[model samples]
Target: MITYSNLGKKGNLGNQLFQIASTIGIAEKNQQEYCFPFWEYSEYFEFQFKECSSVENWTSLREKAFNYYDWEVSHGNFDLNGWLQSERYFSQSINKNLFQFKSDFEIGLLDKYHYLFARKTILVTVRRGDFVNNPNYFQLSYKFYLTALLHQFNNLQEYNIIFTSDSISYCKKHFSFLPNVFFLENLKPIEQLCLGSKFDHYIVSNSTFSWWMAWLGEKKETKIIRPMKIFDGEYSKKNDESDYFPKRWIEHNENEFKLENRYWKLKVYGYFYALQSKIQYDLKRQKKIIKNKIKDIIGYK
Candidate 1:
């Protein structure tokens, strides 16, 4: 039997989908039964898989499982806690068979939003909350998304833009000004994912939630635009250079969008300019102090 863990985290839909997809892929490859015991939100979010008995402690189970199957199991650079990245093994066929709306309630909600999908629809997912508070996690700035939206509208004026986010307040505060931009509100996280999958095009943040939404989309012509840079700050070094994103999706380079906003340019260059001025001031002060000390020594001599 194959078993997986999320390292005891909760409420991260993207990470949870990655874990679930990876688990399903491993189980399919090895022809073994699998269980995802650590996911506490399984009741709320559902996947198409056989449910095995839940284990009490995932950490202990992970160690023992790896030890017993060391010969069969090899950890790769792409593996996240024994669960490999799904795209390595995941395909449209597997996704069609495995990931689906869990409940009749969600299905009803999907139908209610079905009319929106009748036209050329574009889904834009903006990730905030922890990502905003935590500087270490990479996030595409609002300006990057704004640039993408303008580019998309230029090419496809018919596409209706639907905005979804964990931070609805943040979305309204930032994205409300855009024409034809509709906010997805009052839906469960999984429900939101289901709704997003119905869209024809996607403008995604550097988020697994966005990744899965695009991945689960049924249209063959689905256009996915994602940020090339996945992590914020220096943490980019730790991630695999090649493995995170699918080859087919369009990658929006953050550096390309760096100069897109005059405000951002001023903020970045202004901060450095201020720092340079401070350094110069400190150096001049130190030089004057050293000069005074030398003069005092000469006078004493």
Candidate 2:
């Protein structure tokens, strides 16, 4: 068994998710049973995650949780440690049903906002707050966001835009060119993430929070715009000795980010996707209620 008892210690939801997901991925790849500590986010999502218990006859791996090396596989109990961030560790055949909102999750109530996304929509994830003062200069440079928008979209006016951020006021003040965009209030973390996944395109910031917004999306025609490096200012493409961004995503370095090593595409047939589609359809009738309240929850600048 593989265990993640002290996974984050005190990491944010996104950070912990990345590490745990990688553990799941690794366990699946090796066909070994893996166990993690109790997940607090369980209130929002549902999955058959084994709660880690006593560990014995265990060995520890210090790969920094970046890459999946052939030598890292183990048969007995083991421990996974570090800020493991990379799709590489997820293995190509990772489980999709591993994550889904609880049956009572608020996936349906937000579809009224779907009409705002009825047209082409670009969801920009502007994650700041603590990272702004992080000594590593970990935040995405302002230049990265603007440049990604320029290269990916031909006309900003043609698409509906919305953004969710810890610093929404900062985005409103700085992204004046995007005056017509919607400013979504940060909902409960899981609900906000569920909402973030509904967009047609993305401009991801330099955080695991930003990475998962794009990763969890169900849209195939979705266009993603991401910084080449996970963090701004780091020159080594191999950060923490690993590449964080998926090889398939659109990359824009802009010499942005100082650190690296961070880290889902959901298959359409997965239980989550099928359930998600059903929920959206079922929620269609709640349009009047959602429509009346959407404006109150969303801000316009």
Candidate 3:
């Protein structure tokens, strides 16, 4: 039997789904009976695997397994931890079966937004909550989004840009001026995931939540734009260590391109760049202050 403990690990909805998907992938590959022990947050998602089962004694089994084998070597041997994120190990067929929305509310929301799916839609996932406040995480500038949008769609007026985010207010405050921009608010995490998967194209933020959403719906025709850096200045140098970004997706780097012999256009581009930098700096500071206040209020050390 193949089983893993899902206790005491504080993870977002995306990571939890990935864990379950990884287990399903491993079980199919190894032809083992897979079981995922329930955690507090398991009820938030609906997962089903024909050969998989759940048990209450997940913690006890996990402890016994750890005591019997070297934790690092044994865990890595099965390729359990990295399978979901790695392109080499990921099985789309298995994952598609594992993650499904069980709630009627979530399924209804997907149907409500079916009109967007029928049209030429570009899903833009902007992660704000903890990513903006945390220095360790990579937060892409609005300029990156602009660059990617301009690169992908020469005529932005033709397609609908659907913005889904943790902070809808933040998206509206910054991106409301853009043409064809629309926001979907007050959605459950699973609902957001389902909605995002239906889009024709994706402009994803440097967060695992956005990554999973893009991965779920990826197709031969699908175009995905991802940030080149996944962390701040010094930390971003280590991006080569992980196989997070798929080969087919476009990676948008932060470097400025020089416009040759177009003096007027160069000046205009420089002005926009300067303005974007200032706005990004201010937003980062504000988010950090807000995060600190919340942490203090919650007495989180």
Q: Which candidate tops TM-score? A: 2
Error of 2 at 168 (Å): 1.0
Worst 10 residues of 3 by lDDT: 61-70
lDDT of 3 by residue, 1-301 (tens): 5554552253776766656665555555665556655555455456643322544443222222111122222222232333244444445575565555566755687779766665578888888766763566776655567667777666888888898888787677656767888898887776787777768889999877898888877878888988875676655564342566776888876456432353455446546764775688788788989999999999998
For model 1, the local distance difference test gives 0.64
The candidate that achieves the highest lDDT relative to the unseen native structure: 2
Clashes of 3: 0
Each candidate's root-mean-square deviation in Å?
10.5, 16.2, 7.0
lDDT of each: 0.64, 0.68, 0.64
- Tens-digit lDDT track of model 2 for 155-248: 8888878878997876675565563588877477777787777678898877788888898874678888876555435434345534677767
What tens-digit string does per-residue lDDT give for candidate 1 at 111-187? 78776765578888888655653446765666667767766456444667798988777567666666666889898
Off by over 4 Å in 2: 8-10, 64-68, 91-94, 133-135, 176-179, 232-238, 253-301
TM-score of 3: 0.70
Which pairs of residues collide in candidate 1? 138-232
- Candidate 3 stretches with Cα past 4 Å from truth are 39-84, 100-107, 233-241, 257-301
